[model samples]
Target: MKAYFTYSCILLVFVLQACQSNRKTETKNGGIVKYKITGKVDFNDGMQVYLQNYDNELQQFQKTTVKDGEFILEGELVSDGIYNLIVKTDYKDKDTGKKSFRITYPVFLENNCDYEFKVQKYRDGNVIQAAEIITNSEASNNLFVFEKEVAKVKQTWDTRREALSNEAAQLKASLMTIGKGEDSKYNYAIDRMREAGKESQELAKKNPREEVSSLFVNKPEHRTSLITPYLFKYITINENNYARYWTVLDSLDASIQQHPLTIAAKAKVERVKNFYEQMPVFPSITPRNIKGDSLDISKFRDSKLLIIALWSSRDRFSKMDIPTLLNKEPQLKNLGVSVIYLSVEKKFEEWETGNKSLGLGLNSYLLNVTDKDFIVNNYNVSSFPTYIWVEPKSLKIKELRGGDPATPDFLSAIKKAL
Candidate 1:
């Protein structure tokens, strides 16, 4: 089952204000919810704890204490959403001797739920394992799976590499003996031996049993770059983001020369290299309006600020965030900033109906562009809801894919352009 979760704005304002304060508040929601934190570290009595939302924007709620190996951070839950809770400590490591802090997994704060998250760090002589417990099910699962896979892959790769290096070196030395003599027969033998060695390497790669185990086995590391990059490339190709695929494929080619027979490693480099090569170039390409009227982007040359928002009618995020920007059109216009919407829908009729149903502003249009394939390959868009800021007079791109359009950072960027 699919579900859409919503976090209302009313509670966000109150929580945001408290976090911005230099001091920590011990009470919230008429003192109904309270929290405390404790840790061992050499620092002042107070530390800064940050609560971040998904947009990478900081909210106004924070915890500000870590004294006597314990602390108390109290606040009311504003809404249910994902958050990356971080604790900043001044404790320095004995080995590196560098001061550092740690991050906690997602802490879902449900409304009316008095949530308490415990943070712990244990040191076994010189080793430290930091852990946290929260009620966020999704974050816990994501962190757990990611940590396990990454650790296992690193361990397996390190061990297998040592073994492979020894084998490759031995084979190379054995094959080079044929080249010792100066005669033509010796040169032929050397070439034949080299071919034999490559055949052996290919045999090692074709062993499906070993390769399959590497992907699923709990112990031995099996996946190599030669194979993995292609997997990523396939996904990008399916998404019609050929530009990204070409770039990845090219990078893979260079790595293959260095790593030689490491299939997984080689594959990764090629995927990125291929991704870059597939990207389309736009040489002063003009954008078309909804009425099929071609409007050269250069026509906005007189304006100091030109903001372009690229989105599709079917995209749920665009549906939410685009309207938010348009709602503040009057203020944006007052700052001498101009905005334009470009559609990535396949059909012109789809774009028209979508634009009209959404009640988009005057500046919004269904551009001739269709789908992310055309947009991403041509413009190199890496993420959805991408905003491009252009200095029209100079035709130089000020910034591509600006800040989150739904947040205040986007507004700040627009004001700076004017």
Candidate 2:
């Protein structure tokens, strides 16, 4: 695909920006600051720019259209808030003669700020990634700097993953060409990638045994853990966002740091961090398998992640990811992950029938009624079909988050290693 824009124009695809309001209003906080957002663009004319807040909702001040080369936007912010100025380029493909994409970005905003939004990098055909966004506001600029720093870490993580995957691929290909068996290097690379959260996308899709423990992640969307410039707002990337937020909060000006929102956010981040850090290891369960064999969940004394799936036969959605897990058992094993399917059914007979009817497999078991309270309380199993990710080594809890996991908020907590 062709590139979206030239290098000179700045792209403002910020991962997060708060409170970009076109309304000229005052706040109870006292100071009413206005924003002067001006920048050069790659377009010629009839380009549209819209305002969006951290919520991902398009709260448009107006349907704005401007000439491509240079543009200026004016807005009032009562305080520092998250928002984005999304630019939908009137662009066309010269080669394919096709109209490409309408692009938008998430950028932060501050009252009384002068922001220079420039075109940066292109993530794909549709999304334009601004290499840099400069602002006069200290608080806002701090966030930009902080985001860049955090993005670097995220990028480094992905790059290492890519490199490991590539090296593993090269080794495997060389072995194949020579008609030889697997070697230590291949196993080492695979283990490293597993530690890094995922393996090579091509390999994962090609062999079920090579896929991530998440299972059935064949789509391209599953490949990208996303670069720094992503879909993030006040809460950046689940657990990642809070750490960065805390880091920036420490560096902000005293008054800005003391701002009501900042205070609340700081408190929340601290609370969350403390809660997770203090989260006790998952209590072990020794339930009977569908095979009528005794099983103890705490036997794995190594670095293999445990994906404990809690579901009921009555709740259809509860067993949704089960078949995929079963079919991709090899894949899970490769990733050093184990699946423990515990049905939260009331009757033992119901679990027996459900397992046969649904073919829940040997890994599936009915949570003993006596053990139900123990499992439910420890795992925090509220809903019917919940997948609890228990961390390896520490045996701490890492649950599926991100409100839908598909959304910006999904295991998201799995940012924690298995």
Candidate with the greatest TM-score versus the true structure: 2
> Which 10 consecutive positions of candidate 1 have the poorest summed lDDT?
22-31
Residue 186: error of model 2 in Å?
19
lDDT of each: 0.52, 0.56
Listed per candidate, the RMSD to the true structure in angstroms reads: 23.5, 13.7
Taking the tens digit of each residue's C-alpha lDDT, what string does model 2 give over 198-250?
54443333322212211211223222111111122224224444565456545
Candidate 1 lDDT by residue in tens digits, 106-211? 5533223333445345453222255655432332333344445656655665556556656656655765565545567555555665665555554444433234
Task: For candidate 2, give the lDDT of residue 247.
Answer: 60
What stretches of model 2 exceed 4 Å from their correct place?
A: 1-58, 62-78, 81-136, 139-251, 264-275, 290-293, 377-379, 400-418
Q: Candidate 1's C-alpha lDDT?
A: 0.52
Residue 225 local lDDT, model 1? 23
Count of backbone clashes for each model?
52, 23
Model 2 worst lDDT window (10 residues): 222-231
Q: At residue 408, what lDDT does model 2 achieve?
A: 43
